[model samples]
Structure formats: structure tokens, C-alpha cells
Target: MKSVHLTEGRPLAVILRFTLPLFLGNMFMQLYNLVDTVIVGRFLGENALAAVGSTGTIIFLVQGLATGLTTGFTVLTAQHFGAMDPKGTRRSASNALMLSFGVILILTFFSTLFMHRILLIMNTPAEIYDDAYRYIIVICAGLFSIVLYTLGSSLLTAVGNSRLPLVFLMVGAVCNIALDLLFIPGFGMGTEGAAYATVISQVIAALVAAVYIGRKMPDLRPYRDFWRLDRGMAIRQIRVGVPMALQFGITASGTMVLQTAVNTFGPTAVAAFTAASKMSTLLTQGFAALGQSMAAYGGQNYGAARPDRIRSGVKAAMQIDVAYAALISILILLLLHPLMRLFFPAGTDTGKLMEFARPYIYFSMSCYIPLGMIFIFRNIMQGCGYGFLPMMGGVVELVARVIPAAVSMRLGSYLLAAACDASAWLTAGLFTAFAYHFYVIGRIEQRIRRGRARMDASPPAPKKE
Candidate 1:
């Protein structure tokens, strides 16, 4: 029951305090994914790793959509909390919870039934298609756990309670790791075992999060009054959220296109791509967590009508981001060989895998600063009730990733897939920068001007008083 203390005067201190727990929590979440990969790689074998990797695009699409919608909920909750409207928060939260469950159930059903068909549409190769289908089917069937975990975590983050989510994530990660060992090695379950472990852990985390929310924050909890559907609120949430979800899905679809390109190169290349993406995500988690913190910070202040505080928070976030980006980039470059070895091992064309990945990592570094800016910009917009900009940025990324990948494949070079990723960052960064200028800077300046005019006009009245 520790308080968030977000309304304190020191914005940086407040944000950092809030962000640290989130950072740790996100790291554990990333670790859960990494551990799954590691167990599958070391114990289950390369084909197993490929099996899991093959579903990367689909997972990103489904999970990213859920995450995006959950983000919309978070934005609404933070705004209501900032405005000191507990009843509104409760109503919005209830609507969001109901909507999320319904959407998740629908997605779970479709994804499960068409898992194989979707993979074929992605042009999954002949040799690996069966394993990929097996892996995806199991994962999709357990989509509720994934959705619930995200929904719970998003709600907690929205209310400025990051620590609880982190604790739950740690418990889940531990459970996942233990289950991975038992199911994969002890029971000889293979890739299906790994997928099962993941879903079970998700269920545990979701349950823990739900219990905490119900017990601790009674004021913010959904009451019976809030349970009946409010058409306007539901529409507003979906309007804000669906675009964001589509944006992620669109962007992930581009990745699926890229995955198709990588698959064309064979399983070795697919494995390499999978390893690189996982490693990069591991590194990126720190900054991503910071970005989420900024979103909450910005969203709350924006709702409270404190534009200055949002500006200050963005500056502080940028400073932290730069330092983190540099450190992570250096670590990635310096330890590239060792890191690859850790995942791919020595005997299995590790050298070739590294060769394929080195350039992509280097290119990724070129855009880290811009990438950081994108997070700041997008979060700022979301905080200010300008959710559309973030969604637009997602669409820009989707287009950027897809076009280059398609053109590159036409010319027969896998390197283009890496190039497409970098291009997406550039496109997203530019759009986000524009949003900053128009929405943030423009609004703040207008506010300042109006404030000055009001002050000038009020002087005569004060003198008379």
C-alpha cells in the first residue's frame, strides 16, 4: 500500500522513483522471454529454437495489439487519477477490463483456429512449418493468460504502482524458469513444453495482479455501479485504443514480412534473426521502462493541467535515455561475440550468425538517439490526450518496415531486412518530432500567452482591492 507520491514538487525525483520499479519489472518480463529461448536452445535443440522463433511475428502482432489497447486504458486511468476523479477512474477501469477480456477471447479463438493458415500466409518454409504450427497453436490457445497479465500490469502502471507488478513479474519469471526445466528436460516436452511454461506463468502473474488491485485500491476499484456498459466511454476507449492496436499489428505485420524474408534464407538465418531480436529487446528494456514511466508522469500531469511539469519530465527522461543508450550500445558491440556464443553455442555456425547480426546491431545504434526521442515524443503526446499521434507513428513504422523489406527481397539481399528496421525507427522518430512541435510546444506556448494576458488584465482590479 505504498503511495505513488506523483503530485510532489520534484518531477524528476518522482519519475525516477516510479520508474525504478518499472524498470526492474520490465527486465524480469524480458528475462522470462529470454529464459524461454535459452531453455529451448540449450535443452530442446536448434529446431526447437526455430520452432519458437518462427512464431515471433505472430506473437508480436497479437501481444502488441493487446499491449496497445492496455496502454489506452492506462492513459485514461492516469488522466482520471490526475484530475482527482476516482469515480471516473473506476468506471473507465471496469469498462476497460470487460472490453479487454472480450477482445482477448475473440483474438484467442481466431489465432488458435487459424494458427497454421496464418503461418502459411506468412510463407513459412516447408521444413519448419509443422513445428512452427505446433508451437503457435499452443501459444495462441493460452492467449487469455497473456492478455490478462498485460491488462493487470497496465492497470497497475496506470495508477502509479509499478512495484507490485514487478514483484508479480519476478514470481512469474521464477515459475517460468522452473517449469521450463521440468517440462522440457524432465518430461521431454520440447517446444510445446516451453510454450506451456510461458502461459502458466502468465496466468499466475495475472491472478496476483488482479488480487492486489482488488484488495489495495478500493476507491479505484470497479464498483457495481460501473459494471453496466457505458457506450460513450467504451467508444472513447476503443477509439483511442483500436488505432494504437492496429498500429502495432500493422508494424508487426511488417516484421512478419521481414520474417518471411529471413525464412527464405533458411533456418540458420531465422535462428540468427531470432537471437539478435531477443538480445536487442533485452538491452532495450531499460529505456522502454523509462519511456513507460514518462508516459504515466506526463499523462497524470497533463490531466492535472500542468504543462510545465510535463516539459520538465521529458527533459529528465531524455538525459537518462542518452546515458542508457550509450551504455547499452557499447555493451552490445563489445560483447557481441560472447553473447552470440551464449545463445548459439560454438559448434553451430556461430561465426556466420554473428556476421549476419553485426551490421544490424551497428545500424541499430545509429538510430538509438532518434529512437529515444520517439519514446519521449510519443509518451508526451499520450500524456496530453493526443493519443492519435502515437498511433500515427506506429503506422509510419509499419510502412517504413514493409516497403524496404519487400524491395530488398526483390533484389535478393537479406541485409535489407535489417535496413528496414532502421528505416522504421527513422520514420517513427520524424513523426514523433513533428508531434512534439505541434501538440506539445504549440499548446504550451499558447497557454503561456493566455496566462500573461490574464495577468495583465487583472492588475487594475487588484490595485482597487
Candidate 2:
């Protein structure tokens, strides 16, 4: 139940402490997806796996946009918390909830309406389209829960309440897995069953998160006026949220483009890539958690006007990023065989599938340090309430993926996949770092120096201890 006020703690220690539950929570979250994949792949077969996988990018597009908007709420809340302004924090939360619901309603309505067309635009395989359509529509139809759950999680984490979300997700994961078993194979529900399980679990988690905030964090409970729109705060909220949403959307679009190319390679290729992508996602969860923690950490310090803490926290985060990349790279290499065989049906071509996906894992492992950096640099800039450069970093990622993916598809799917992802990560990482260095670091230092000089010029207050 202990939550960190990161501005007052050792930068490295607090970040690591904060990141641990986030890491665990992300694992469970990824496990939620993995369970669905394993169930569908094992129960229904490769085509079903492809069907489920085919929707991943589109889901990310919608869900990522929701997450980005939620992050705007989180950054504001954390800033107010750091500054010891509970009323502002509560109001921010109220505003976030109201704004987010409007966004989610829009997303749910439109995405559900156009789900099939979007799938067609992605050039989904005809044989798998029915199954994919069933799953995507079910999921998108329930997109309201998805956005709510994600926003709830982000809100909780912003207050340094990472464990609550983790606990919720752990229960959700269990619920999801059990339901996956029952719905997929037990009842012969197939892809639709898996989608149902996901949506149901998310609703449970979101409900818990929503209720917990009201009960446990009374000060963070909004007053009636907090629910009414404040023009200035709403503008600030949208200002931060929109660019971040665009960043997620643009980056997801790049992956959507890659997904289209993967579809062209056949169902077998689709299945292999799906498994590998899941593995890559699972492996890098820690790094992503680190990024989220950094955003919270830096945002708190930024609100407290402590540039020194932000700098130190980011440095510590990058060090941890390196350690994580190295460890995960080795693990991926060591367990490649057994891991690859786990997702496929008993009689499927596990060997061929693993081999086909090998280059992606290998290349991704090699470039993970940079991938980790992208999460840090971009989110740190986001933490500081600066989004333009970070949004541009996402554009760089889009171009990096698109050119290689478009030009290299004829060479081989594996090579193209590897190049596309690796190039995107490296390019985005470099651009963000440059932006942080040039735009953020100097200005923060100047503020810190000016504050220090003013304090030096003024007479010190007498201690009354």
C-alpha cells in the first residue's frame, strides 16, 4: 500500500522500487494476451492464430490512442501530487475521466462500425478473415472496457499505486485464462470466446480500479465542480493527450503497415510472426515498464521544479535499460527452441516456424538497448509535458519501418521484419535523444540555476527546531 513520492527519494532506488510492480503487472498483462494466443492456436489451429494475430495492430492503434490520452491525465495528476495539491490532483482525475469517456465512446462506436473494413484494408487473408472478424469485432465492440481499464491503470500508477493495478491484473489474468480454457476449447467457442474472455476480464479490472480510487484515496476524489469543465485545464489536458495519442497512432500505423506485409507471406508466416511478436513483447515488458516509471518519476520532479532529480532518474533508468536488454537478449537466445514450440499445435511445423521467426528475435535482441532508450527518452520528454519532438520521433519510426518493409519484402519476410523493427527502434531512439539533449536538458538546467541563484541572493529563514 506504500506509494512513492519520487521527488523526495533517491532517484535510482525509487525508480527501481516503482518499476518492480509495473514490471510484474506488465508480465501479467502480456500473459493475458499470451494465454489467448496459446488457446486459439492450440484449440483452433494455425489459421485461428493468424486470425487473432491479424488484429493485433488495429487493436494497438485504438488502444494505444486511449493509453496516450490517459497518460496526459496521469502526468497532470502526478505533477499536482508532487506539488502537494490534492484538489488539483482530484480535479485532474475528474477531468481525465470525463474527457476519456467521451474519447472512448467515440472510439468504440467508430471502430466497431468499421471493424470489417479496417480488416479488409489491412488485406486480411480470406480464409482467416471470418475468424479474425469475429474476434476483432467482439473485442472492438467492447472497446469501452479496454479504454477504461487502460486509463484506470495509468491513473493508479501515476499516484505510485502500481501494486493495485498489478493485483487487479493478476486476478484478471487468472479470470482470463480460466475463461480462455472454458470458452475456447471447453465450449468450442474458438476465437470469439477468447475475445470475450479478454473483454470480460478488462471490465473486472477497470471496475476494481475505479472503486478502489474512490475508497482508498479520498483526497483524490473529485468535488462536484471538478466534474464541470474548466476551459484552461481541459485545454492543457487535450494539449498533452492529443500529441501523445498521435504518437501512438502513428507508431501503430507503422506496425499496421508491417502487419499487412506479414499477411502477404501466407498463414504459416502469419502464425510464426505472431508467436515471435508475442515473445518479443513479453521479453521487453520490463523495458516498457521502466519507461512508464520514468514518466511518473520525471513528472513528479518536474512538477516539484527539480531538474536534478529528472536528470539523475533518467540516467538510472537508462542504466537499468541496458541491464534488462542484455539479460533478455541472452534469455531469448537460450530458450528459442522450447519457447517457439509452445504456441503451435502438437503436429504443426514448429521447427520451420521457429526458424522463420529467428531473424526477428535475433535482430530485435541486438537492438533492444536502443528500443529501451526510445521508451525512456520519449516518455521523459512526455513527462516534462513536451510532445512535439516525441511525436516526431514516432514519425521517424514510421518512416524507418515503412521504407525497409516496402523495399525489402521481396528479399524475405524474416529479413524484412527484422530490418523494419530494428531500424524503427534505432531511428526513433536517436531522434528522441537528440531532442531531449537540445531542447529539454539545457532549459531545465537554466531553470535550476536561476532558482539556486535567487535562493543564494535571498536571506535564509531561521530554523525554529
Best by lDDT: 2
Candidate 1 error regions (>4 Å): 440-465
| TM-score of candidate 2 to 2 decimals | 0.95
- Each candidate: how many clashes? 0, 0
Q: Write the per-residue lDDT of candidate 1 for residues 321-365, one digit (tens) a residue.
A: 788889988988887777776665347778788767776787787
TM-scores for every predicted model: 0.93, 0.95
lDDT of each: 0.80, 0.86
Tell me the RMSD of model 2 versus the true structure.
2.8
Pull out the clashing pairs in model 1: none
Query: Could you tell me which 10 consecutive residues in candidate 2 have the lowest summed lDDT?
Result: 409-418
Give candidate 2 regions above 4 Å deviation.
Answer: 410-414, 447-465
